[model samples]
Target: MILEAVMLQVKEGMESKYEEAFREASKIISSMNGYISHELQRCMEVKGKYLLLVQWETLEDHTVGFRNSNEYQEWKKQLHHFYDPFPIVEHFSRVML
Candidate 1:
């Protein structure tokens, strides 16, 4: 499995609206191929900060299958405007110790 992490900085006073928009956008992501699950966490120290974590079966499932799909456009339309400087997304895999 792969984990996709994003640190989101929402525009001031748009937290509630962003959450609502994310709720709708969540459906779009959940329906995509190779999607495992996802979670959105609000930051305790920062007022307009959030952490978005998503699980996928493979890297291509997100970087290719999802990002390249039409659903992503809708996802962007719904939640992109709420961001201030935009978020950087990173993917990770488990490491054996």
Candidate 2:
């Protein structure tokens, strides 16, 4: 599985609204192909910081399948504006221990 990670810094005073929009945008992402699961974690020490983790069956499932779809536009419309500076999304795979 591929893990997608993003560090989101929401605009000041927009945390609540951002969370609400995130909840709505979740549906759009969840319905996409090859999506395994996702979680949004708020930072306890930072008011506007959040960590978003998403598991996908493949990198293209997100980089292409989702990002290329119309649903992505909806996702962007809902949550993109809340970001202070745009977040960088990175993908990872499990490392053998």
By lDDT, who's the top model here? Answer: 1
Query: For model 1, what is the alpha-carbon lDDT of residue 5?
Result: 99
Model 2 local distance difference test score: 0.96
Encode model 1's per-residue lDDT on 6-88: one tens digit a residue. 99999999999999999989999999999999999999999999999999999999999999999999999999999989889
Shift in Å, residue 69, candidate 1? 0.4
lDDT of 2 at 24: 86
Clashes, model 2? 0
Give the range of the ten consecutive residues with the poorest summed lDDT in model 2. Answer: 88-97
Candidate 2, which segments miss by more than 4 Å at Cα? none
Residue-pair clashes per prediction, in order, are 0, 0
Q: How many backbone clashes does candidate 1 have?
A: 0
User: Per-residue error at 94 for model 1, in Å?
Assistant: 1.0
| Pairs with steric clashes in candidate 1 | none
What is the TM-score (0 to 1) of candidate 1? 0.97
